[model samples]
Target: MDSGQEALTLLLLAPLFFICMVIEYRILKKRGYSDYSLKEVVCNFSLAGLHQAADLIATLLLMPFFLWLYQFRLLDFSLTPVTLIVLFILQDFFYYWFHRASHHIHWLWASHIAHHSSEKMNFTTAFRQSLTYPLSGMWLFWTPLMVIGFPPSAVVLIVALNLGFQFFVHTRIVKKLGWLENIFNTPSHHRVHHARNPEYIDKNFAGVLIIWDKWFGTFVEEKPSLVIDYGIPKQVNSWNPFVTTFHQWRTMLTLALSTKPTPFHIRLRYLFGSPKFADNAEKRGTTIK
Candidate 1:
């Protein structure tokens, strides 16, 4: 499916999405654990709208760039049943690195924090994407697929599929999936990914599969003993979607262009290095929580 087809698919799934949200709310409320306020749900939808708008602007650059790269395709691979399967794996692999980098690298995190800004996790939270992602160089992560001869159409369609699979894993309503949790990116694994706890930080970066997290040292299984605290360490406690979207951008600029006779290298580090590096440049490792 192309972008248009993907849009149609998501549109068709809207009712199901609403139903899932309602069911999750009802169940969680029954269990006396659901804390989702009406205003919070509205915030989720608003942020999602903001993300979709920015995503459209992003495709203006991404679609053309991928197509241009496809012209120099090194090898022509037909989209057989086998090739699509291989491309899906490749796409997931690349998405892993992109997702991981977005956490470790400050510049990338500026665009990614929006998705994690919400303290609550639900299907709607998956829609809370950053407006800055396109400019944050996320599109460049997939360039390797184009250079390696994967058709642009297949590359984009596979990416959409990966994203579609990820939406359901955002909920706290579902816990472990028994055997499936061992292979796929289930809600349990993703809960760890979204966690603000020291042990859970930056773990489980897989887009569709959990195997990549296992291959990478980044994988951390959810600990039933410890309660998961969702949201980033630096919280954005605003209901305004624009405020949530631009919070990091403002923070980045302020940190990068500080009035303190900050050296060029330090400023550069704030713009490109680890999120914590900007403060106390020599500081290393996780600051004790």
Candidate 2:
């Protein structure tokens, strides 16, 4: 499938997404759980709209380059059933690294933090995305697939499928599945992913398969005795879409561009290293928090 087909597929499934959100909202409210608030839901979808718009523009601009790069593919691949299955696994593997890097690298986190900004973990919470993802070089993660002889269209479709599968795992309604939780990324595993607890932070970066996390040693189980607090360590308290999207960008840029007497490498680390390093830099009064 090409970009047009990808968009069409998502458009057709749009109603299903809304239906699931409504069902989750009703169920949470009926159970007297405060997971679904009107304001947060609206903010989630608003950020989603901006994200979609930016993604569409980025896809158009970047698709040509991917197509041009496909000419010198290392291996030729036909879109057979077996190849599609292979593509799915490879795409998930790449997504896992992309997600892990987003957490560790301050540059990417400046965009990804918007998705984790919400304190609520309902179905609509999955809708929260950053419009700056394209700028943050998210599409770079899938370039390997394109260069390995998979059609750019096929890669796009597989990415869409991987992301669609992840949407269902954003809810708190579903408990841990039996053995499937060990293999697939379940709601329980995802809850741990979104949790702010020190043990949970930067864990469970699987997009479809949980095995990557296990093999890579980043997997952490959700503790029944522990309460999960959603949202980042530093919260973006504003509901304004611009503030929610660009707040981290402001912090990161200000820190990286500060005129302090620090070495150039430390300033570079502020832009490209972990948020922990950035926090330390801020604590030294090198930059505003």
Candidate 3:
């Protein structure tokens, strides 16, 4: 995972995204879903850039920790192609559970909700990541890779590649790929995941493969003619990323503390409950089809 290798890996994967985008745009045009205004596209691009910058800064700040892990033999630096592929698959496997937990665990959802806040499903939405994740123990999810002999650098690269693959799946341009859609996490699947519709909420948590969701009972097929309304039901419409990320968290903390005789279970649920739990539990249940 030297700089040259890292750069090359990104370069190689970059074209995949471009190709996917082209395919998506063409499909959207054919389906008459290509009604995006220039202004909206520009806004989405700007937000994506801002998020990328945040991720860059976060990665730099976390570099020392990764380096330290490598220096102490907490991580091994193997670079064979097979090992790298295995690491990539393993990372996505862990990512699946981490993502699933973020939906079920209240505290983690506070940090993860930003990525789901967009009403429009596109590649830009895929870049809309939360800056609060590092503070929320996301790095711990990858520790098993290190413990099992994957190098920290390799793990980081594989993780990045995994994420890069997902960017293409956020768009509405590409529809179902028939069998491919069933076996993989496509835009169709992810759109359902992002939907606030009762049947769509909390489904399709895979990062790369759809098998994880199917095996775990979280899979849901896209229902044709049923439109997806994105964003949390209680929308956090603020453009301020910080507000969007922490507002729910703050409210949840207050609720947890204010509730008298709060059992550990209630506190836990407060952290991970559906976004509308405080307003209407029955509604939240109904919202989740």
TM-score for all predictions? 0.92, 0.96, 0.78
The TM-score measured for candidate 3 stands at 0.78
Residue-pair clashes per candidate, as listed? 0, 0, 7
lDDT tens digits by residue: candidate 2, 1-289: 2555455656677898989988987888899998877788788889988987887888888877988998979999988999999999999999999999999999999999999998888888888999999999999999999888899998888888888888899999888899998899999999999999888999999999999999999999889999999998888898888899999999888888877666788778889999888977666776533
Q: Comparing candidate 1 with candidate 3, which one achieves the higher TM-score?
A: 1
Lowest summed lDDT across 10 adjacent residues in model 3 is found at: 280-289
In model 3, what lDDT does residue 92 have?
89
The digit string of per-residue lDDT tens for model 1 on 238-266 reads 88888888888777777787676777877
Single out the weakest 10-residue window by summed lDDT for candidate 2: 1-10
Segments of candidate 2 deviating more than 4 angstroms = 287-289
On the 0 to 100 scale, the lDDT of residue 217 in model 3 is 95
Segments of candidate 3 deviating more than 4 angstroms: 1-77, 257-269, 272-289
Task: Report the CA-based lDDT of candidate 1 relative to the real structure.
Answer: 0.81
Which lDDT value does model 2 have at 113?
Answer: 95
Please say which candidate is ahead in TM-score: 1 or 2: 2
C-alpha positional error of residue 123 in candidate 3 after TM-score superposition, expressed in Å: 2.1
